[model samples]
Target: MAPNRWLRPEVYPLFAATGVAVGICGLSLFRHITINPEVRVNKENRAAGILENFAEGEKYKEHFLRKFVRNKSPEIMPSVNGFFTDPSRN
Candidate 1:
């Protein structure tokens, strides 16, 4: 007998058809889950909107970092330094 003879030829087509059906169902389900309805509707302008949001976030992050550094005083420095120096504090 052939190595693959354990599965009869008659059942092979059934397995192939089942696999194709399952594959199509899986793809449809995955698309339904991952795709946002709003994004799908405005697909034409999605890239531009995403880029604008990303740029806005970067500007906010820069402003926050600058403000944080400018507001840091000498009084708060010692506590920050001591936290790292003393191992027993852990």
Candidate 2:
């Protein structure tokens, strides 16, 4: 009797990677279904529905990364931006 070929130490990483990929895809799908207003709202009250949907959307809140950078300078490196923008520094 031969052991299962799929059950091997070398193939474990592949299984892990596959699981992670599937999990990410599942989460993305779930997020799209739940959070996407366009998909949630229908034609009956599209005008009001969209507005309401957007209002609900706002309640869910923005991503942490966006909130972190909101109202922040667009510059990636402030020193470099200052060096180029400051006439006195030239």
Candidate 3:
């Protein structure tokens, strides 16, 4: 009965603080690994079988945004681009 009373108001802040601290640490670690090319190039950071192949290892951590944008057609606005380039538009 008495033990249950300790679980009320004061513990919420402690839980919130712990969650925030964990989020901050996770974000910091991610940023550290991402922006630091030295970390990216480290052999240990790469996938297991790819350790000997630097170029293949790079594919493992290549940013999702870069992968999405790669080899895409250069049209900034497809309809407008077509309007300018199409001989029929003239």
In candidate 2, position 40 carries an lDDT of: 51
Candidate maximizing TM-score? 2
Sorted by lDDT (best first), the order is 2, 3, 1
Candidate 1 per-residue lDDT over residues 1-90, each given as its tens digit: 775675888888998999999999998677555553324345575655544356645554466458777866656578888899889899
Ranked candidates (TM-score, high to low): 2, 3, 1
Worst 10 residues of 1 by lDDT: 33-42
Candidate 2's C-alpha lDDT? 0.77
Worst 10 residues of 3 by lDDT: 44-53
Listed in order, each prediction's TM-score against the native is 0.35, 0.51, 0.38
lDDT of 1: 0.67
* Cα RMSD, model 2: 7.0
Off by over 4 Å in 3: 1-6, 41-90
| Highest-lDDT candidate | 2
Q: Which residue pairs show collisions in model 2? A: none
Candidate 3: what lDDT? Answer: 0.74
Stronger candidate by lDDT (1 vs 2):
2
The residue-by-residue lDDT of candidate 2 on 9-50, one tens digit each, is 999999999999999999989978777665654557555543
Q: How many pairs of residues collide in model 2?
A: 0
